[model samples]
Target: MSDPTDAADLTIEQLAAEVGMTVRNIRAHQSRGLLDPPEVRGRTGYYGRAHVDRLRLIRDMQADGLNLAAIQKLVGSGGEEFVGFRRALATPFETGGAQIVAGAEVRRLLGVEDIDEATITRAGRLGLFRPLGEDRYEVTSPRLLTAAAEVGAIGLRPEVGLDVLEKLDRHAQAIAKIFVELFLAEIWKPFQRAGMPPEDWPRVRDALERLRPLAGEALLGMFEPAMTVAVEKAAERVVERIARDAEKGR
Candidate 1:
């Protein structure tokens, strides 16, 4: 069926013509309780924007491979909650433009003299690069690329940088699962168990919208102190080793 017609009321036959449906089909929908009863003025029941909208929704549900019986059940059971859930799920987590760099530039950034086929394949597997052919790649996460470059500047080899990334990626995935499970258990399950109240939909969606940045900030906040403690411990070991080497030399 076509989109709901301009905010004007129409007769059943007029609505059928407007929405590309037969008059018989319109009556059948009304019989199935799929369409709302029209406003009756005397003997002739007039259809309105609401009727047009409901008809359009039925058409869409049918197009999505749902049978009439299923559509009836779904529409009878609050469909507004489904729409709210979809909107909440569609909330974006991250936003950034991808950067394309030549293979030579990539090598330079990683402080490598050359990039072998193996290195390219490994980077692709790690989701760091998408080969664009002709020796160019799309950097999936520019922030990660920048971090690799900084580490490379401090004399870490490209392979070593990739190794660190691979290990960190495993930890990152686990961290993501933790947050996702937390959301499902603490927020989503309660909402679902509550029968997904219409009025509470906004609160659920707002919680989803707030989750992403909160997760990011929490990770960074924890990582900072952890990194500092790790560095201090590593430096102590290095100093002890240097002192032992000096004693041996004497």
Candidate 2:
């Protein structure tokens, strides 16, 4: 058995298996600057946990709808810079800490005693929580779980919260598509056509990091007013119905 602390002991095949990636995909990621080259030891390159972590991060970003270009920019920053950039990108959206709890505990946390299995599956699909093993789950975001719990407390079914999240996921996907198209057209394409000199990589990375916060701010700015308008219209309709009911009662 290879010592876990000895990173030099892992072969390419072992690394691929550990990270759940194909060897070709790992090489592709290395070419795209999303991963570092492995250390060479007597004609064989040895990979370590860092490579595994980078692969996992890339996969997570892809799951979050980021394309390779975006992932490259984020990961190309290197070391502390990349860490800071990733934290900046995540700070706006995820405010609470995560918790790992058993599946039974998840049901308790969600305030659903007899939750349907399909509803739990849908919740996982919508990024509510990830299954840890047979009977455990890692709640990705406590704030989201709290919101679900609150909704359930208000007499709505837990499945209703999952439905709402599914709708929001659809809307988010649409918005992501538009933004990616705009970014590709306005930013990446022009840079590519300009010959994409090696010297320009840092500038591109900087632009991506800067835009991360700006995009978050823009989404919040847009969503707040839209939500306000929606709430106001709904309130007006409810008021009108109440007034009509009062007149009929009189």
Candidate 3:
């Protein structure tokens, strides 16, 4: 099947396969009104890319131990804002300080685990921990150090969080570099050579005043943790050197 995001149509079976769910299961959720199918096309009913995406999202949340009820609640509460919020939340917030615990009450509302200072701090520096107000933060840090630490706690040493943070710092730098260059080169195209008419200038002029920073955040924001692996692979030598240095604590 074509990419669900860009595809014109997807059959029930195709949607099921794309989302790795059985046709019966997909239909069952639809029957339960958990998901909605798109417009019917010809003999085969087709779901839009958004439907496929929502299904995949549900699948991932289910995999992460969210029950259907919780998913529904979470999804429903956001509504028109859901897509934007989900897209934003899809990427882990990056920070380099204990911003989360510094504002622990909010995270408690989201059932996010309380992590140590390193996890909080690193996430803050990465812009992963978003400040709500009065020193409160949303446990949306990109590192997810607490989640990883919880796993290790059940079996191995907790200090592994340090390694994760160190690795994240290196990867975060690469992402920032990519985002900075992309905006500086592409987004600034109109302003590079000349000025605009006073009447028509607001959009372009305001974009410089407004969108430049937001675009920087949005682009870097989408570079999820999984992309870090791509960075590692592309710079395998750098990874090796970083790894060696970590091994020596230098």
* Best of the candidates, TM-score: 1
How many Å off is the CA of 64 in candidate 1? 9.3
TM-score of each: 0.73, 0.60, 0.33
Task: Give the local distance difference test score of model 3.
Answer: 0.60
Give the per-residue lDDT of model 1 (tens digit) for 1-250: 4344444468888899877789998999999999888888888878878787678777766666668897787676545444555556765564556789998988888888888889888887876777899988999877788888998999888899899989988999999999999989999899879866667777777788788889999999999999999999999999999999999999
Per-residue lDDT of 83 in model 2: 46
Report the C-alpha lDDT of model 3 over 1-250, residue by residue, as the tens digit.
5576555477887888888899998887787677886577676687877888778777766765668786776555433333333344444333433444455543443234664666566555644465556666765543454655454656644345446666866875887677557545765454434432233334443444454467557766666665897887879988898999999996
Point out where model 1 deviates above 4 Å.
Answer: 1-6, 10-35, 38-81, 100-108, 111-117, 132-136
> What TM value does model 3 have?
0.33
Q: Give the better candidate number (2 or 3) by lDDT.
A: 2
lDDT of 2 by residue, 100-163 (tens): 8887878986777755678767888887888777788889877778778887888888878777
Q: Give candidate 1's total backbone clashes.
A: 0
In angstroms, give how far residue 21 of model 3 lies from its true place.
1.2
Q: Which regions of candidate 3 deviate over 4 angstroms? A: 5-8, 79-250
Highest lDDT: give the candidate number.
Answer: 1
Ranking by lDDT: 1, 2, 3
